[model samples]
Target chain A: SQTIHQWPATLVQPVGSPLSLECTVEGTSNPNLYWYRQAAGRGLQLLFYSVGIGQISSEVPQNLSASRPQDRQFILSSKKLLLSDSGFYLCAWSRGGRAEAFFGQGTRLTVV
Target chain B: QKEVEQDPGPLSVPEGAIVSLNCTYSNSAFQYFMWYRQYSRKGPELLMYTYSSGNKEDGRFTAQVDKSSKYISLFIRDSQPSDSATYLCAAPSSSGSARQLTFGSGTQLTVLP
Candidate 1:
């Protein structure tokens, strides 16, 4: 069975601080990885996706970036966080050519 | 118009009542349709997935897709308090460039005891 693991279930960071969120998947190879943010009273927005190692596609241009260091390890980072960056972050993985993706527990970040 | 439109209703219904949640899309190229349930602060969980048009049922949940009308529905039979959550409708991106899934705003359902 395939499973996704994400860290820092909840985070509280000050403005202009650096941020790092990690996601790792097991039981799959060359899987598609995605990062999504869900704002209050809004739909989940796609932030970044990776097709393979060292390849990242960003949907929304913001203060955040994603990197695929390994086949199953994905990282979302930000040099300086903004107040608007506060939201629930989710990590998901799917097989190539598949539409359904599995999600991780998610990280709730609050910027003050 | 947004690609997918769903009513963000804090719909409150009595237990055992049948709940109907719906979403409409403007994209005809969307070939895959799915329903996901998200608890208060947890990640969304896949509830149902369907392709093309027709109905697919699992246990007490039934998913219906009408491609001609560009509408999809999720029906919950004998709803319970455990079913209280947000239901979101999703489909793969039609743009072919990225495999990201587009989502509806989501409908919040509350099953009252």
Candidate 2:
């Protein structure tokens, strides 16, 4: 079975501090990975997605960037965080163009 | 207009009652429809996936897609308190590797015991 793992399940960061969130998948290779953020009472917003290593497509312009260092390892990072960057971040993986997506436990970021 | 729209309902229902969650989309190019459930502060879990138009059932859950109307629905029979969560609707376009998913503003459901 395929599973996704995300670290620092909860994070509290000071404004303008650097941020890093990691996601890794097991039991699958070459799967597409995605980064999404959900604000309170809002829909899931697509931040970035990667098809392969070193390839990332960003949907929204922000202070954050994503990288695929390995076939199953994806990282979301920011040099300086903003108050607006606080939200629940999710990592998801899918096979090819499939509609079914498997998500990790998610990271709750609180920027104060 | 947004590509996908869903009512963000804090809908409260009694246990054992039937629950209906819905979403509508304006994009006709979307070929894949899915329903996801998310607990508080957790990630959304895929519950149902359907292609084109028709109905698919899995256990107590039934997913219905009407492409002609660009509407989708998820029905939960014999609902339980454990089913309390937010339901999100997602659709992927036919563009393949682009594989972007458009999401609806989820509806929060609570099954009162």
Candidate 3:
């Protein structure tokens, strides 16, 4: 079975500070990875997706960026956090094509 | 208009009742549909997936998709309090990486004991 791990499970970052969130998938290789943010009372917003190492496609333009440093490791980063960046961040993985996605426990990021 | 639309219902239902959740999409090119359930403050969990226009059942959950109408639905039978959560509908676009899913604003469902 495949499992995705994201951390820290909860984060409290001060305004203008830098941010870094990591996601790693075990038991799967060359999986499609995605980063999504869910605002309070809103739907999941796709931020970035990676097909392979060093390949990242950003869906939404914001204060965040993503990187696939390794086949199973994805990272979401921000040079400067904004108050609007507060949300529930999720990391998901799929085998490619129309396969069902599996998600991690998610990280609750509160940018104060 | 958004590609996918879903009612943001804080729908309340009693235990053992049948529950229905729905979403409508504006894009006709969407071919694959899926339903996801998210617990409060948790990641969305894939519940059911359907391709094109048809119905698929898994245990207590039923997923229906109508490509001609661009509508999709999820039904939960014998609902329990543990089933309470937000439901999100997703459809894959026709463009690159058809696996990329476009999501609808989720509907929150609560099953009372």
Candidate 4:
């Protein structure tokens, strides 16, 4: 069975601070990875997605960026965070032409 | 306007009652539709998905898609308190480079015990 691991479960960062969220998938290779943010009362917004290693596609230009360093490892990062950047961040993956994605336990980040 | 739209209902229903959730899409880029269930603090879990138009059932849940009308529906039979969660309808967009799933605002359902 394939599983996704993401961390830290919760984060509180000061304004202008850096952010890094990591996610890894086991039991799959060359899987498409995605990063999403869910604000209160809002749906999951796609931030970034990767088709393969070193290939990242961003949905909307924002303060965040994603990278696929390894086949199953994805990283979401920001050089400087904003107050509006606070939300529930999720990591998901799908492969073999499956449209439905499997999501990971999200990280609740609060920018104070 | 959002590509996919949901009621975002905080609907409350008695246990064993039937529950319905719906969403509407407006464009052709969305080829597949899916329903996901999210607890209060966890990530959304894929409940079911349908590529074409029709109904698919699993245990206590049924998913229906009508491409001609661009409508998606999920029905729960004999609902339990464990079924209380936010139900979100989503579809993949082919217009953008990401080609990832676009979601609706989600309907929060609570099956009261």
- The most accurate candidate by DockQ is 2
| CAPRI-style grade of the A/B interface in model 3 | medium
RMSD of 2: 1.0
lDDT of 2 by residue, B1-113 (tens): 99999999989999999999999999989888999999998899999899989999999999999999999999999999999999999998644485878899999999999
lDDT of 3 by residue, A1-112 (tens): 8889999999999999999999999998899999988887678888998888998998888889999999999999999999999989999998877557788989999999
TM-score of each: 0.98, 0.97, 0.96, 0.96
Candidate 2 vs candidate 4: the lDDT winner is 2
Taking the candidates one at a time, how many backbone clashes does each contain? 0, 0, 0, 0
**Candidate 3: tens digits of C-alpha lDDT, residues B25-48:** 998888788899999878889988
Measured with C-alpha atoms, the lDDT of residue A66 in candidate 4 is 92
lDDT of 2 by residue, A7-89 (tens): 88999999999999999999998999999999877798989998899999988999999999999999999999999999999
State the DockQ, from 0 to 1, for candidate 4. Answer: 0.63
Residue B84 error for model 2, in Å?
0.4
Evaluation by lDDT, superior candidate among 3 and 4: 4
Per model, kept true contacts as a fraction are: 0.51, 0.67, 0.58, 0.64
Q: Rate the local accuracy (lDDT) of all candidates.
A: 0.94, 0.92, 0.89, 0.92
C-alpha DockQ of every model: 0.66, 0.77, 0.66, 0.63
Deviating ranges (above 4 Å) for candidate 1 = B94-98
Model 3 chain A lDDT-worst window of ten: A94-103
| Candidate 4 chain B lowest-lDDT run of ten | B93-102
Interface RMSD of the candidates, in order:
1.5, 1.1, 1.7, 2.0
Q: What CAPRI-style quality would you assign to candidate 1?
A: medium
